[model samples]
Target: MIIYLLLAIIIGYLVFVAIRIGLHQRLPLALGPISLELIPDRAAKKYRERPIFTIDIPCHWEIEALKTRYIDPLAWSAKRIQSTAGMLASLLQHQFNLQYGERVAIFKQNHFDIHLFTISIIRAGGIACPVNGKLSINDFDPYLANLSATILITDSAAILKFLQSGIDFGCCRKLIIAEKRALKSEIEVTALEEQMARSYPDIQIYWLEEALLSVQKESPAVPRGKDDPLYLVHSSGTTGFPKAVILKNGPQAHAVRGWLCYVHLSRTWDKGFGALPNNHQAVILSFNSLLLLGFPAHWSSSYDHLDFNAEEVMRALADGKFTGYFGFPVTYTQLKEVPAEKYDLSAMRIWGSTADASHEVIQRKFVSIGNAFKAFGIPLKGSIFLDAQGSSEVGTPSVIRYFTRYTNTFDRRIGRIGSTPFGPKIRIVKENGEKVKRGEVGKLEVKGKTVFAGYWNNPALTYQAIHGNWFFTGDVVRLNKDGHLIQLDRLVDVIHTSDGEVYSLPIEEKLHKHPAVFDVCVYAHQQPDGTYLPSVAAALKVKNSISNSLLLHEFNQMLEGKEKLCRCEIMEWSEFPIGVTGKTLKRVFRNRSEQMMK
Candidate 1:
């Protein structure tokens, strides 16, 4: 009996250590080369056991950790940083007056700015509706009408523009302006405040700074439960008018917990750096992950500044000793054009590119960094690369892949698609809802903890998008025999020419390879004869002027015998319009092509 007791104690100790190692340390380490055995059939059973939550905002120096470890060594107190939560609590207490249980519409310049207010509104038991700042005045008015916002908080210029455009304020009873030095003199701030005081005596106009300092932080009130609607984010509006996607704190909290597991982040260092805009997933990942997980973050204000000079960024990384960095393909492509040794990037441990990157080009760039550059004939040392795959709708990241070897063939295998550690199921289904055979292309659907509830206030569209808990991603993809997902193309962007031949994303990828091409968009345009012709539009950053005819000749040489494209297809060149989200507005190019042909 004594011997049996001792043996049982030893077995229990071993099991505890195994669980700790698997959950916190070893899981993220094996993410790059994970196997089926590593993730068992009962993978999601743990998620069903209990609820875990965390929230952080690095700018405000707020940190909240639950069921995890945060890797910050600075030991900075939460009081030292500006508190976004505090700002919102003040707005609700003294300045703004919304009727009982009224919805507030927040139209800020970017995602991070809006988050400062949105989170507070949700905490105060009010609904938040965030509008995309990139939309034109015409597109924004209808949304405002639909939401019937009682208060409008925005920059001074936006207020003036709305008034000048003849928008009836109707139910909008208050306007609070967050003044910037650049616009302070141009727009008479005092005059506007005085005018609002007189014209609409009941309407209030308050400055952001004064309001924040005057009001004291109140104890958080009992908010609606996790299942109640907290906030709504507008979609990209690629297919048609944008729809608002509603989200609850419960689903978002669970999704974040799953991401923590998927990234294997407990033991990983918490340093987030990225150049992408706040309106996209780049900001969501960098801000949310850092804040919730107790990580430090460094951010740049503009994407263009980061894309032009990677050497400056590398030098900063060396100075700050950042362990992680994230950016788009353009940023990395620009880095490849420079001599990597000139910049001290030894401090970087993990680097990722979220936007589309050609596997061969990216690998070649890495090789040039770690090996010999033919132009300079100087050898360089390469760094490890981390890659992520997800969209804005999910609100959480999935499908992470890492590469250690500087091989060109890396893109041929899983260039982007990998599995989530949270046990979310990925499936490829044909238009008719049948599962495609292995290696066959079809629409991608994700059934996971991270998927959002649905488009906010647009029940008809929501019903169409989410069928029985599966979110139709609308992206064409395929699965290999090894179960790795491969993204093919966007179903909406596929072009069908008058000749009945189908041209797809490969042509666009090939066009982007040219050094002169900064960006490219391919779509179908109606010809003078009323027949749809496959057309390609490109934006050139290079200074050397190349004529349309010369471009056509080069394109024909590249796709001479390719079945997907015809030699006589039309091509146009213009500057690309970048949105606040740091995404190229491909729809703008499509609209331009339609107008030009007409």
Candidate 2:
């Protein structure tokens, strides 16, 4: 009997290996000409070797190239960035004295921040860096010196900030302030322009519109390649000083291609709606991937605006006929609050949730929408809701796990192997650097051409992050026996209690399930005696009428039998602060808790 069992086990292992190899061979053909190629001594490259067509949309101000085809040779040229690139090139050719390696800074004041300006600067062979317009004097001064920006292109607001901060314009040789429409009257406009001229006598201030009119529309082409520096994306300054993440063309192009394949954007029927802020990863995927793959995309001013009137979005779906949508868990929850039949969302083909993992409630809501579409006899295909596990450091696009059909079974093996049609290489490792057994939790690391090169500068930090060309995604995850990856929690968010116990995602997920809670953050509060207390801060929805005391009582009742949490560890409830990305700012909660203890 023992000999027969051993033979069966050996045969099972061989079958698994054969299946994995066969799937890898068949995937490219099944997914429409996508392949992963291993380059000899050049690192593994994953992309279509043949040139692929795409479309470029550079501005929100106009929709000119709505259905244009972007061929490879023309796309790499100066015109694809924006029409502004041609304008800047003309200015450089005529008015500005050309230097071999000069850097240019661009600032514009409009309700919507312009990404085209940064693209234009890169096309002009100039290093482009945009400063935060809202930063105080103390904050802005240090960053200015860090980049050593030589030219300034801004509006009155940025110029005024510079003046208020008493920053010497000696380093900045030229200052071109954009003409503002806010100065309504011609007389007022001229007077304001004259005043700016007088304020910076030595600095040259030229009207951008006037420059455009005088110069030719055609611009001299700037030579570029895969390794050219594209832009600097700054990290949020929540933890400490913000680091400038330097992104290059090679890695960025790889990311754009990977996104195109992952999202299946090459299909003519593909369309997406983006409501996340301009600076976040969702926008990056929507804009860059669309531009790179010729996919149609749309965006709202803000997610909050969309949440207020989700019917507007449904109306858009009916009018524009969108197929895909990307949003966070909070946005999904808001959609659940409204009745489904009020608007026609049957046009939606695929829906994605990012920034945070999808809660059970949100997943149920999505599954219901899918079921409703089918019930109405609309040809609405079953949807895909993915949990994207990656970081900004990993080129803003990385590993993805899709939940196509919602099930109560938490069998983590649903989508584990690269043998699947749409799966990437996944591995879970222990702290001492060994692959953990299946059904065990450990740090998750991913290796692919999709990963970012590294943080812009700060080599010391980058060295610590990327090991043997693999991006160490600071997330705790596990792979089940069925080969599916399950994310546990962020490494930093894990709370270590005084009793030497670790309580992580269970508390946060449980609190979020409460009817009174709209959102919640769980963290550790350290006492003067060095003992840490588990604290939970939450934001209750306006609709919930339960008092704080009742909410607390309900919470204690829920945790009575759970061995992971103690009764004494229950912290006070406070209003949760929100970030620009609409996530509950856990860092702010931790700070507030420390203040209360003091």
Candidate 3:
């Protein structure tokens, strides 16, 4: 009887509340920031708009304004991206029997065609897996097993290498070759293709050119929802080859569209510039946003073009080539190394760099770099440099700090990365999963509209990565009282010595501030006692007459009396091996440590 009375009381309260809300004329339901009007639906259901499907999402924005060209080897606009995508989709479905949700690995470099080819995979409702273009046959073996991808699409050289190696990639059933450049000897290419077909008779091979030219559009798109997986990108393998992580359609598009809206990429923005490889997440974010928002893509470079010099970039811009620029630290730093008077950079706006933070010299050079931009106001600048902090998994940036080279009040400390970008709620948490107070050092966790779904086909790793809705970024950071973020080091990179935990970043940051130091890498060296000691490996701007011992002695003065564990050593740039992303790998230091002793 008491239970019935309580139930009746709750029901009456709900009914009263509902009646009052129903009678109100101006009451709008608010969920977060979006407001919804709770109006009664009419009896005619047929008059309502048709349900939207993920497949209905535009494969290509069909915006001719969005163009890409390559300057080094030279290519022009990618015409009819939509029709070409449809044709490629037809080929993938009919020729290779590509099913929706199946994986196709694209082993290619950064190119305009790669984007179109990837878009085709999307239209076919297949997961587009693009690995590092620099991966050799040996590297491909492990990735092949990891991806278990049914189809492998690559250039002529890669396929030939795999065939010549005589390694059976058991998982892949088909090979699709895209030989855009016809410079390779026709007979040699033909012989290799023939040999590949014979060696791997089980794996059927086809050409992307044939698909584009011959295939007629049949069935349109594979039915998929917005929540379905879109692109399978890699984590930034600053340490090693990163795992394949999945980015979904619904959340990705939602997040990307919002970011585009915030950036406001209009016609006035003009041609944007970026040299990020197609495999890099920044490339994905850039092209996808530009194309989707009807903004133009960057000019395409030829297939044979390996790299760009600072002079080439400056001359291009000086010739009224591009309006916007997005470059990595090394690219911008090259421009910085040369005198600013060497090039005319006045046409450029929205200049920025990501991937890695700038060194002290690079930052100073950036100040020198911004001096060329003549257009600006009190609050605005002729040109701004975005020294941003973000990774592959997170599509949108977490922190972005802009710099005007002309500012008088500017502090040139590169320690502070910046505040958060659009999308993603970031929290600094303790090991116990509790949020750390401001000015406290803790682990970084993120969750938002743009965060990746999880690592591809690795449930155990995925489980470890994501806790509930928040993804553990594995970076250890400190939030200062000013709301700026300072990256100490990666959680795994944090060395635990007798001093408890020693962050390499602070030491690196300090050493980098030294006049002679250009760049440095810090790693924990295992002593004979089995206790690890922090070791600093530095590359200097120039070789001085001072001996190595004196240099070490001078550098060690910075770490004096604080921690007995750290030892400073300066090495030539050639000796300190850098990875593809330009990070000094700890593994290389470890591998050569014994050699160094000898």
The per-model lDDT (C-alpha) reads: 0.54, 0.53, 0.60
Residues 41-99, model 3: lDDT tens digits: 11012122221101101321121222232122222222344544556777788878888
lDDT (10s digit) by residue, model 1, range 1-598: 9999999988876665445323544333233332111111112122221112122222222223210233442222222122335446446655674443466776655424554566556545667776756566776777776666787767666676665565655577776665433345545766766655655676677666555555555424334665666566666566556666666665555554555564422333435566655545335434443344444555553344223466776676667666556676556655555566676655454566664433445544553332112112224455456566656566554465656555434423443343555534667788888988887777877777657787765788878988878888666766666666665556766554555533445566667677666555566665566545555666565544576667767765665343233323233332445544344555665576668776
State the displacement of the C-alpha of residue 482, model 2, in Å, after optimal TM-score superposition.
3.5
Best by TM-score: 3
Candidate ranking under lDDT, highest first, comes to 3, 1, 2
**Candidate 2: RMSD over Cα atoms?**
8.9
lDDT for residue 153 in candidate 1, whole number 0-100: 68
TM-score of model number 2: 0.73
Better TM-score candidate (2, 3): 3
Q: Please tell me which model should have the higher TM-score, number 1 or number 2.
A: 1
Candidate that would win on lDDT: 3
Model 3 scores a TM of 0.79
Task: State TM-scores per candidate.
Answer: 0.75, 0.73, 0.79
